[model samples]
Target: MSKAVRAVALVLGALWTAPNTVIGLLGGVAGLACGAQVHWRPRDLALVFDRWPWGPGGAITFGNVILHTGDALDVVCSTYAQRAAPCADPDIVLADHERAHVFQYMALGPLFLPLYLLCGGVSVRNRFERAADRYAMTGRGWWPWP
Candidate 1:
């Protein structure tokens, strides 16, 4: 990705995930101030912050810090994985899957959050998610549902 496109993605991602970013930044600062160890690494478009595992795995956010479990960063983006062990290169299919989410965010802006929440009913969410997964797996087609 060119620097210009990366810059735009950063801005758009920050905007789309503004609420999460604020909470994440505060959490990160608190973690730092309290002496909670943090591991930072550069990823495709953002930084990955490995915090003490509080749950099963990590979460992907559009913010600067992508939180993850101590084991493996649960989140995967275009070409980055958060882990101490050397991770294999990102699979093109998985990358495409995540790219679809990025596009969804771009298309919906802040509305994406509420819409995503509203779509939480298994059937609806699955429709969208399946489309993305299929796109990744097939390397062709667009999301089937709005």
Candidate 2:
């Protein structure tokens, strides 16, 4: 996609997921206050919004917390701390997986949140997550499976 198109998409995507992004920003600030370093990758904004809510194994059960159980994004808020550089081999695979979820949010728009909750379970097992996994593992050519 062209730069302009991509920019528009990002803006729209951010807007579509604003609630989650805001929560993420707040969580990110808290994480920073708690000594977690911030990381950002230019290729995709996911890393930019990513934040390790608390140290490993630490849980803070609040709004949308479940959405960030793993390397997740409830529209925003990632629960891991790492470099902001371009993803490498294995990391790229993982990033692809998460990227698929981004597309899911884009497609579902406002309905993504409720549907995700309704789906339940982790991404590996959830229906929506499985679709994302398939998209990542395969491609978008065969989406909205029958």
Candidate 3:
């Protein structure tokens, strides 16, 4: 597997307890390049989640997805990697996958999550995953997947 592929797999493995929406690794600097607007370290993510009453993860103002679990990636859910994962224009797989979520949010507008939960999320999530994979394959040398 490529670096991007491995990273994605590693991130997905860490994030999914229910297989709802796994957005992949949070590459800090890289994530910023990719449009992630937060300035967070791995420890900060852990602290927030560990200390928070609601749970480990929650959505940030700019659409960043913060997973509270240890080593959990902080992602920008708006742009690529939801503007969370670090990559100034990620590898093909990463960008494509992340962008798919962006598109979904665009299509659903404000009602994305609520509708997603009500719609048996598996289908939409699967569709987005497939979108990333497909987009990655066709993206040429855009993202090395590493």
Cα RMSD (Å) per model? 7.9, 8.7, 15.7
* Candidate No. with top lDDT: 1
Model 3 bad stretches (over 4 Å): 1-92, 122-125, 139-146
Candidate with top TM-score is: 2
Please tell me which model should have the higher lDDT, number 1 or number 3: 1
lDDT of each: 0.50, 0.49, 0.36
Q: Rank order by lDDT, top first?
A: 1, 2, 3
Worst lDDT run of 10 residues, candidate 2, spans 58-67
lDDT score, candidate 3, position 109: 41
TM-score of 1: 0.49
Clashing pairs for predicted structure model 2, backbone only: none
lDDT of 3 by residue, 20-114 (tens): 22232233233445444433434222112211223223321111233232232333223234343564443343333343343344334455566
